[model samples]
Target: MTIEWKGVMPAVTTKFTDQDTLDLQMFEVNINAQIEAGVHGIILGGTLGEASTLSDEEKRILVKTTVNIVKNKVPVIINIAEQTTKGAIEAARKAEEDGASGLMMLPPMRYKAGDRETVIYFKEVAKSTHLPIMIYNNPVDYKIEVTLDMFEELLAFDNIKAVKESTRDISNVTRIKNRFGDRLKILSGVDTLALESLLMGADGWVAGLVDAFPAETVAIYELQKAGKIKEAIAIYRWFLPLLELDINPKLVQNIKLAEVATGIGTENVRAPRLPLVGEERKTVLKVIENGLKTRPELPDYKNSDLM
Candidate 1:
């Protein structure tokens, strides 16, 4: 599948069973829901998917499962958050072998690599695979920003196609467009900044809350792109509270709770990350409940050719 590198590409969460096994049934349910809701692509084993906890075999299974589930209707992108250059290269090759359409790679995990090291790591991984890559430039969480200088150096790799812009500085979208001039596709990685980023010329959104509210998420992107600004803002205003959940430390749990509320998923996460509880749970649930109570009737943005 040729990746368009645009539209609502969800960083979907991985579902688990009570015995702590991959719940393939529920995973399929969510993936189908995302596709039916008009998402352009699906990303597996991302932060929201609990990438660090997953073994290499488990990640491979996810790639195969998503590739099979989407059936080439949308690209299945696997996230590579390895601790070493060798590990990242191996994972990239494995994803391509497992039938992934592309990769969403972060800078080498664990030890923060400097500018030169980061560029080299990404370049080596790029050289190792035929798959196009989207650099996860999230300095705020990962602590090492892939600055413009590094991006300039990286432009030599034809496979380095896009950036998941999570820097949270909305202006960075314009800066990237100015610097690269459409050479690199920009997807807003922050849920809270999604609409603004899209309006400011982001190519797409690598979304978090879309796991549960796939239609609403897709609607916002489609409406914005169709030039229906007023209609998009109406839904985005209602979605703001729920979208903010993506920024929290417990976002996975919060979004899982949402999936439960919507009957699309379960709250069964892996260990070291328990389900939300007490006031945290209550507060999060309150937001979800309120959003549900007043969920807006979506416009027929799907009929627009922008999709």
Candidate 2:
């Protein structure tokens, strides 16, 4: 499957039934909705997808299900969050075996390996699969920056083709472009920074809240790419308050709540995580509600675009 890899590719959340099993039916519904909304790709088993909490079997199932449902509409990229090189290699191989078109790999989780260990981990995993890889560089949350020097080392692996630029340092976007040029596809990983990152040359957005509001997320990206900067900024300014929700630790719960409000998915999440409550829940709901009340109309946006 060929994916443009240059528009909104949501790091979709994993849906669960009340009993906490993977909600395959609802998951299919969510994936189909995203495809209808003109998303350039779909990434499963992301942090937002509750990867760290899901069983290995469940992760593979998510990959296989998405590949089948997506068909050739767009790339199905699976996120691998293992703590060991061997584990990451195994995860990448599993994703490829299940017919995934690409992988979004994080550095070794929980252990915070330094530069040498991190680069080695990515290289080893890249060798194990033929799928194109997007190295997730979220130093703000992951605590290990894949510095430009580190990326220089990664350049040896031809399959290491993209960077999820979530350093939260907006300058990194330009830095990556300056250092690597077209060697890497820089995708903005933070929702609040999506517009800025794009303005600075990010090729796409690996969005979090788009799971709830796919059309708006995609519309902003399309507007910006079309050189309609004023229209894009207008939509992005209105989106900023809600977009901030994706950067917090509670993002999973917060985004799922927005999904529930938007009618795309449920707010149910796995344990060690809980549903939003009290003021936290109310505040997030108000943002979604207020946005819906005054949601901007996309130029040439249509109901059929969502079919």
Candidate 3:
């Protein structure tokens, strides 16, 4: 299947049982909600999905299950974050073999590679699989900025198709458009910047908090695309405090808290990560509660068939 690489693709949180096992039943429930809410695609094992802690076998299960549940209703993309180039290639190939529609790849994990090494890592992985790739360029979190020059090097492969632009320098959205002119499709990776990125020509959003409020997330993107800027901003402003949750260090915990309040997912995460508690938990829940109180009456919108 051809991945469209556009519009409100939630970096879905991986659900786990109390025993820390993959909760496939609850996962399918959440995925069905996303589809019903009109999300364009499903991304598994992403940052929001706790890719860093998931085992390879677990990741493959995620990819296969998502693909099966989605049933071609949307593309199922898996994230590949590994420390070694060979490991990255193996993961990418595994995603393809497991029936993923695309891959969202980060630069080599842990050791921040220089520009040269990063380019080589991406190109080699792209060479190893036929799956389309969305290069995740989030210097603020990932520490390796995929500069336009580096992207120029990656253009040799047609499968290296899109970018998840989380540089946090919003102007890079414009710079990417100015420089690449659709040669590279850009998806806003930051929730707070999603509106600005769309206005500036980003083709889509790989959202975080969308896991909690799928209808509002899809509505904002659809309204913006339809030129209802004022309507879009109203929802975005109401959403800002909660959207801010996506950028913080504790995003996974924060978002899961929102999910539990909204229903459809659990707050249980793996080892080394705990559910939010005390004032931190209260503060996040307050934001979600307040947002819910005034939640916009979302107009019915269909999923973008922009592909």
Candidate 4:
């Protein structure tokens, strides 16, 4: 569907201190850089941001910090998802009260079985908040399959405006775009499939790599929007490999490491998630180096660049 949101909105990470507390300063620093680089939008408290581990206070800080830093320059969607419908609604209500532009909500986690029960779960959460909600479809991470029919049913509610589809199945992107094309906002969740999804009629994407390289993300969208497919493809090819790491359980640390490697943001992460080391760190660094070599104009690694 034609809508106000589109293109390379990174699932922004929440920076933290070694003590595992929220690093509000670095959060502002990173968010401001993404905004200045011209991302189509910004997302706070998404999976890539490790929203699962953050406390309610921390989540509130994330929403307020992001909304203030963005200052309405681009769309800022807050992830208001929890294990309970009440918690999710509370988070969504808080984000709305704090002035977030939109909300991306995940299904209730920590449960098992039954599609009918799942439907009721969604119905309850949907009823709790008035904010525009993007139903997150991420079975890979959450272990719950939010089916196409379920999504269609959710659409009966007027506030369910968008979706983050990440089944790792590109065809579903086409399916959602085709089936719900007239009704919901279809945002391809995987960064690697941004190109395919775009051509397949997805209105936009929520990218993980955009955290480390907002300029490149914005460039790909701009190039394609200008009908420069070849240029856009080049950018996508360079990012596809790194983007795949978003599927990795180590996504938060991986993107943070990429930030450290490129001076985009801190590699600082909360525990029990340790910093990457040994072969893992080496592998991630190589990806960053090659990505930089492929596009040197994409800002050199420098402290000044992050701010």
Candidate 5:
């Protein structure tokens, strides 16, 4: 499957059993739901997918499982959030070998690399892989900004093809467009900012909450593209509260709770991280319940010829 680098590509959560093993069954269920809801691609082992805690072997299994499940209907992408350049390269090569169509990579984690070092790390990894890459430019959360100058240097690499724009500054979408034109595809990484970013000319959405509400997420993107602004805005307004959960510190837990409410997933998270509980869990659940109760009837955006 060739990655078009457009449309809704979910950064899906890594499903785990109560014993903390990969729950391939539930993972398949969610991936199937995303594809059925009209998402463009599957991203495995991302921030939402709990990349840091997953073993290298587990990540490979996820890529392979998604590849088989998606069966070439859509591209399966793996996220590389390694702490070292060598590790990142190895992960990229392994993902390609595991049949991933593309990669969504973060800047070298833990160590805050300066501009030169960051660019070097990305270039070296790009040099190592044949697969198309989407640089996860999430300076707000990751703390290492891949500024335009660094991007200019990275422009020499043909495979460094796109960016997951999560800076939270909506204007960065236009800044990227102005600087690179169509040289790099920009996918809005922040959930709450997705529609606005799309309106600002982002090529796609690297969506987080689509794990729970895939249909609503895809509808917003498809409707916006089809020039149905009034319909899109109606859903977007109702979706804002649930979308806000993605920006929280406990986003994985919060979204998994939402998934549980929707009956598509479980709330089991690997430790060091745990499932939401007590008042916090109650608060998140209220938001999810409200969204579910008032879930809007979607127009036939999927069948729109305009898209």
Candidate 6:
């Protein structure tokens, strides 16, 4: 299937209340806001969404809510990474039934797999669902590398159509583009590498900061696509500090902080992922303050609403 995935696909967060119940309204509100802001697509239950912490029922709700809100206005990619192939496949089936446009899958974590084993894990999921697969190579979180060779092996499966390259290496991105450019779509997953990814050869970006700054990310990407290189770079530079800050394991906290400071989602993330406080809060605030200082004077962007 030819799934046209492109532009800013936010790995959107699942909003939670102070009592830790899912704030479905806030989540839908943000999804609507992101769609209205011109996001190309949405990837629910990814790292930014705190997928690792959510229960299966919560995930179903998140996906169902997103599909209902988006209404096929754009593609929806659901990240399904579990310890067992069966669980991942089950989730993918449910996501397709719930109306996800495709599935982004990561191999089982903690227990590292060899090349053959990794391929087997994904191939099992690929066979289970008709939804397109986005092979996720997130070495930091999963501790397993989906190497170029492993990718080539996975590509033999009819459903594995794309990849989310989170390794943050531009050369590797170039290599993948050169090799599999014709066969599969490659999405840049690292926020800091979004610009370089586009410039180097990535088809799109799965942006974490899009939770708060969809316009900036989409604008830079659209600018470059339109061949306005200088304009794109200007925005890229303006966005670097914000992007760099997202690489922190405290990404959920940082994005929520941006959401709270600006007029986006709440600063409330689920526990284990606490709201920033003490020096951490001060550090994030300083970074944001400095980022805003260098940010271009776009009219109405820095208005009282975002403040």
Worst 10 residues of 1 by lDDT: 298-307
Give the Å shift of residue 20 in candidate 6: 0.5
Q: Per-residue lDDT of 82-166 in model 6, one digit per residue for the tens?
A: 9887787788889988878888888886568877888999998888888988889988777888899888888899788878889
Query: What is the per-residue lDDT of model 1 for residues 54-108, given as tens digits with 9 covering 90 to 100?
Result: 9888999999998889888999999999999999999999999999999999999
lDDT of 4: 0.77
Candidate with better TM-score, 4 vs 5: 5
Q: What is the lDDT of residue 60 in candidate 2?
A: 88
Models, CA RMSD each: 0.9, 2.3, 1.8, 4.6, 0.8, 4.1
Query: Which residue segments of model 6 deviate by more than 4 Å?
Result: 297-307
Q: Rank the candidates by lDDT, best first.
A: 1, 5, 3, 2, 6, 4
lDDT by residue (183-251, candidate 5, tens digit) is 999999999999999999999999989999999999999999988888899999999999999999999
Error in Å for residue 144 of model 2: 0.6
Model 2, residue 24: C-alpha shift (Å): 1.2
Q: Model 3, 196-231: lDDT tens per residue? A: 999999999999999999999999999999888888
Best model number under lDDT? 1
Between prediction 1 and prediction 4, the one with superior lDDT is 1
Clashes of each: 0, 0, 0, 0, 0, 0
Pairs with steric clashes in candidate 4: none
Structure candidate 5, residue pairs in collision: none
TM-score per candidate, chains pooled: 0.99, 0.96, 0.97, 0.91, 0.99, 0.93
Error of 6 at 113 (Å): 1.6
